[model samples]
Target chain A: MEILLSLFNGILIALEPINLGLAVIGVVVGLFVGAMPGLGSVNGVAILLPFTFVIQSFTGGATSPMIFLAAIYYGAMYGGAISSITLGIPGASTAVATTFDGRPLAMKGMAHVALVAAALASFIGGTVSNVLFTAFAPLLASVALSFGNPEIFALMLLAFATFVGLGGDDIPKTLFSICFGLVLATVGFDIISGEPRLIFFDITGFSHGIRFLVLAIGVYGIGEMIWTINTSRYGSSMSKVDVSWASMIDAMKRFQEAWRGTLIGSLLGFFVGILPAAGATPGSLMSYGVTKMLSKNPKEYGKGAIDGVAAPEAANNSASTGAMLPMMTLGIPGSPTTAVLLAGMVIWGLQPGPLLFTNQPDFVWPLIGSFYVSNLVAVLVNLAFIPVFLWMLRMPFTILAPLIFVLSLVGTYAAYMDMFDVWLMVFVGVGAFFLRILDYPVAPAVLAIVLGPIAEPKLRQSLLLSDGDFSIFFTRPIAGPITVIAIILILLPLFKVIYDKIKGKPAEA
Target chain B: MRRAEIVTAVLLGFFSVYLMWKSGEPPAWDPDVPRFANIGMIDGEGPGSGFWPFWLSAIMLVSCVWIGINWYRKKSPPSVSEEPFLDSYGKRTLFFVGMGLLGFLILIHIIGFYGGILVFMIYYMRFLGRHGWGITSLVSVSLVVFSFFFFDIAMRIVLPKGYLEPLFIPLYDMFL
Candidate 1:
């Protein structure tokens, strides 16, 4: 009853004219950005994050900007399907599974049907997962309220361990990348004491620490620009994207055909999304595989099966919503996009944890409210503006690239009115470009930077409480199990290599 | 790729060692106070300033050494390939675009935010991107004007004007 009342209040807040307008704007921008090849939600959100400062200044509160950013996140998931269905190009990595059947359907000249089915599936998945999020986030936060410093430190350790274990095929590289980020995080003044840690002898900016926004824009925005330019392959044909009442009715009729896959996908996606380092890419891919295995026409799996298109599309959307659960409840992000959102929340001075739900119900409820509204807005806006978004693709990259570059520079500069940050952003961008070439995951690095500050303090506090006894992390009941899980995750990769060697299979590097 | 992997590992290993060394350094030293006390626990306090950083740096050093071993054993996946980091066309694009960004940084320091954007856009579009002059001028002029109205006029966030500071007085008087 309390949740319902709060949700009602949140809905009321979301209905405000400015909030609604921002939601619409967010969805539009998300769709346009997502439809662009190689520019996923991470890039979309990072590039637009600095603009939220402008919005916050206009609105005089963090709530509107939060709503706007969340809406963009939800909208990007919806938009990612457009290119996958039309051109067989996954606009975002999450959309990769959508191309398995989506392109086949387009080849059959049912492009409109495939597009509508994806949008509708995405809508259903998001709405259902959001309902679960609204109910479970508070419950989980209550459980998290009992967590002590040791337990919190254990949880952060588990997050890092999971990234190393499941982040990629290369464990050592992943560990190195995360440690590098943590090292970078240690660069400013020591939080415990007043002395600076890693400040280069005379550089003034190093004393203040590297801003999350600066690094994010540099890596995702500027680094992505360089990557896109380097791998330019812009000329491609797109399927006709005309949606009418007739096509809508056809899609709705086919919904029954793919309902089972959609259900499986939504449930599986939500579950996977709750786990650290398991993002929409894995969620969608897993759903596609499971749906294929269970299908009656398994041979048609990759040959334009509507269920193939429905399953992954549904899964990725639900997974996006599910990723928000841990972020809001425990302040641990489940995926990269949520990591960015977590950083945004921190930047707005809204700490995302149990205290947030209790102390700032206004902020929490409204954000949850926007999730429900934004998903619906995304579906409608996507359906309505298909042609418009496709037309946006016609805009030349030569024009777009320079514009994005300028936006990045201006945005980074706008954050602190500092030229030093702009230079820092460029330097990070260059480093990020190199990192990407080496196939080292950048998300873990970014997450490490965000979690490092929180983890360091917790570790210090726990040690203080336990008189520097490291066993405190293993003796406490909650911390014990969490630490064990973290250890197990860290060892999993080594165990796999051993198992592979025992089986006489070529061990994976 | 193998060479790149080795270089990165060695560089990270050095960085970790440097961090460990730096983490042990205290702000001050006195005969009355315990040496390297910051990295250890105090009698009443649980841990001191350098405790977390010192331990984390140690862990990082171990991880870096592990990476080095993997690289040496030719067991690292990244070390298995000899792929060029970037092809000729990609290298050209990176070089020109990077130079453009460098120019942007230098120009921002000299010409101010809006002025810098104007010149950067014109240079990037006209020279680097090879877009025609008309479109470049159009984009450059519109971006400067839009940023002026948006950040300066509407939001009241005054960006750096550099030498163009005097030119904005009348506009600010009208807007503000």
Candidate 2:
């Protein structure tokens, strides 16, 4: 009852004119920033952090400024899906899984369904996570604290195993792709020993390593565009992007088709987000893999499954909200954006952790109140802007194609301020095109690179603690069960083969 | 398609082997530590710097060989198919697009992003796309102007201006 009263009063304070107006502006700014390649919520909030001081000086409390930043964080989660669906290039790392099915939906002229599913799922995910946050903030933060190195590595292995077990792609090719990406990620200096490794031809650029955006934009933005043009010969399926309002209305009514994915993502993403360093990316990805593994028609995934688009979209938004749990209650940032938000709190002279709620109910409730408010505004703004987004898809293939190429190049350069990366991006794009033609699944490779840097260190640290014993993964309380599951997932195909042989049906795929 | 599959496998296999060799090399600062020393655990440290990449590359090499065996047995679809890897039309399209991109990169180094963007857009719209010069000029010119304002002035990204640096000086004097 006390929680209810605090929340209700918090909602009233959040609805104040200054706070309400700031929410609108922040959401708009965040939406654009998140939808742009090489920019995400972190960049948006970091760049605009200075502006919040001005807001603070006027409002004379940290609540207004904090509300504005939180609104931007919420809005950016919605916007990340925009580029993932329409352009096939993820606007942020968090939305990477969306491209697996979202791009195919766009190609099939059902972009409305993908876009609508993404937006509605995001709204549901955000709201579900908010309720979970309001109910279990302290409990979840304590739970998050217990996740150590071995557990995190086990989770990472589970993510990769899902792709191998449930992914309908060729086995050797998928394994190869995964290995190649992991190796590529190790090109820069070794984090533990501070030793440079695999500096290809000793180019100075190799010292910084291969950046994620370089590879992502290369494969999706440039390679996919070129492949689309080659396959369609310009009169292709992508050119037939549907822009009718009827589809939009129909999409709203038919969103229930993706109910399973939405539910899985909402629940899973919130839990995953509460764990520090495991952010929205892995949450969305794990949700994608889990939804696919459980689906009766697993083949529908990566071929325009509405559930595929919905799952990741929902997960990213849900996880963004869940990420705040640790920040508010434990004084620990669950994700990079939350890290920035923590900094903002520190500057505001507010002490985070268990006492914040007791000492500063005025700040706590209003901030929680703003999460609900910002999520509502974000969905409404996204829905209203649907027509404008669809109009860009109506462009001619030749025009759109060059624009994508230019953006891929310019965005890469802008990201690291390195011309070498721009050239490497083009090279990777050409390589991706060849790999795509040969039916090599590049998605696993993309996933591997994203997780590799994080995975390697956890593995080493765990081994170190256990005196080089591999059993550390299988012996720990939390890590044991997760590790066993991952091993089962990896060996699922071999089990199938053995079963098939016993059944006298040992046929080649 | 069949032959291209084998060739690609062979090339990738070679690349993987090269990576394995490079991974085992000692850090430049401590060359006397011996090659492949970093491929496993050091005495005091956990795993060496080369542990992850060296093992991963070995797996990649094994996968490539598996691909080769599949190709030899005519098991993979690409191995069995009679279709050319890229037909005449695909070849022509690839050559033109590839050359255009190469030219754009060169132009970026020579004339910077703004000037490079202008030329590339005009070439793409007018020549490759077969649009009218009037429309191409209008669209391309408008894009350059919008980019200058958005990336340079408003965001303060300061994209290189190349030979056009002198031309933008007065504008920078006015704005920046």
Candidate 3:
């Protein structure tokens, strides 16, 4: 009953004219960003984070700005399907699975059907996950109140371990990328002793720590722009999309056929998204795989299978909402986009975690309410604006690329009014472009940069509490199980190699 | 690709070593403080300044060596790519775009934020993108004006004005 009243109050807050308008703008902007190649929710959030400062100043509060940012995040999940269905290219990594059947449906001249199905599935998935979050986040935050420094440190280790273990094919490269970020985090000054560790070369701006905002914009924004320019074909044609009222109804009727896949995706995606470092891409892929395994007509799995489209679309959207649980409740971001959101929360003078729920019900509840509103808004806007989004693809890359570059520079500079940050952004962009070409994953590096500073303080605090005993992490019951999980994550690759060798199968990288 | 992997591995190995050595140099020995005490715990108060970096860099060095061994054994994934890293078109595009960005950064230092954006957009849109003069000028001017209203006039956040400092005063007076 209390939860219902809080939710009702949240809806009332979200219905204010300015808050509603910002949510609409956030959803629209998210759609445009997500439809563009090489731009995902992470870049969308990062690029728009500076604008939140402006919004906060206008509104004289953080509530509306937070709502706007979270709405962008929800809308981007729905928007990522645009290119996947129309052009056989995924606008974001979460839409990669959507391309399997989505592209085939387009080839069969049913692009509109696939697009509508995806939007609806995304809405259902996001709504369901938001409900789960509403029920579970407070409970989880209350439980997390007992976590001390040791447990928090152990949790961070578990997050990193998941990235190394399940992130990709190359464990060594991923580990190297993560260590590189940690090294960067150690720059400026040591918080514990106020001593400088790695800033001895005396560069112009070495004393100030490297901002995650600058690095994020550089790597994800400019680095991706460069990669897209290099790899994309200059002028490609897109499939024609046709949607009408009759076709919409027809598409709705088909939803019953794929309801099982949608349900499975929502369940799996929500669960996977709550785990540290597991994100939408993995959730979507796992759901797609499971759907295929359970399908009676497995032979028709990937060849324009509506279930295939429903499964990943639902899973990715649900996973995006599910990622918010840890970010809001535990101050642990499960994905890069959430990391950027966490940074925004910090900038707004709102510390996320248990205290946020207790002290700032006005801010927290309305943001949750905005998610429900934005998911519905996305479905409506996407359905109404499909042709407009398709026309957006016709814009030349030559124009789009330069605009993105300019925005990245301006956004980075706006963070602290520092020209030095602009220069740093370019340097990181150039370096990241090369690393990307070498097949190194950049998400782990970004996550490490955000989590590294937090982990260091907790680790030192735990050691101090234990009187410098190294065994303190393993001695505590909560942290001990988490540490064991981290150890297993580290050793899992080695075990895989040994298992493959013993089975006389060639070992995979 | 194989060659790139080899060079990267070697560079990382040396960089990690340098980091480990540098982490040990700070807070030099005193009679009251034991040698390397800063890298360990400080009288049961917790780990000191050098603790996290020193151990993390050691782990990095080990990972680098492991990468090097994989390279030597010809077992790395990058060892098998026969294609060139970038084709001619890709190389040309990257070079021009990279130079344009570098020029923009240098210009921002001298011309201020809005002024630098104006010049950079004109160059990027007109020269690199090959847009018409009208489109280029319109976009360049509109973006600067919009930024002025958004960041300066309404938000009251003062952007770096460089020589254009005087030009924004009237607008700020009218708005603020």
Q: Score the docking of each candidate (DockQ).
A: 0.43, 0.72, 0.47
Encode model 1's per-residue lDDT on A259-325: one tens digit a residue.
8778878977776676666667667766776676567776676668888888888898899988888
Predictions in order: chain A TM-score: 0.60, 0.97, 0.62
Please write out the lDDT profile of model 3 over residues A1-509, one tens digit for every residue.
88778887998888789998998999988886675544578867887899999999999888899889887887788777886666544567677667667766765657767887788889888989989888888675445456778887887786677557323567788788888777778777888888767764667486687766566667756886787677664432233444567766787787777887788788777766666666786677667656765678655655688887988899988999888888888899878899999999998899898678789888888888888888888889888886565453445666656766877776666556788878888888888888878777665676577668778898999999989887988999989998988888768778999999999998766
Fraction of the native A-B contacts that model 1 recovers: 0.65
lDDT of 2 at A152: 91
- Write down the DockQ of candidate 2: 0.72
| Model 2 steric clash pairs | none
- Please tell me what DockQ candidate 3 reaches: 0.47
Best candidate according to DockQ: 2
Give the per-residue lDDT of model 2 (tens digit) for A1-509.
98989999998899999999999998988887788766678878887888999999999999999999999998888888888888887888888899899999989988888888999999999999999999889888888788899999998999898877433646778889989988988989998999998999989988999988888889988888889889989774765655677778898887988999999999999998988888898899889988998888888999999999989889999999999999999898988899999999999989998999999999999999999999999999998888787776887877778877877787677666888999999989989998989988888888888889889999999888887889999998999999999999888877887888889994343
Q: Give lDDT: candidate 2, residue B8.
A: 95
Docking class of 2: medium
Docking class of 3: acceptable
What iRMS does model 3 reach?
Answer: 2.5
Cα lDDT tens digits for candidate 3, B45-88 = 68888788778888888877877787777776776776677778
Ranking by TM-score: 2, 3, 1
Worst 10 residues of 3 chain A by lDDT: A233-242
Question: Deviation in angstroms for A142 in model 2?
Answer: 1.1
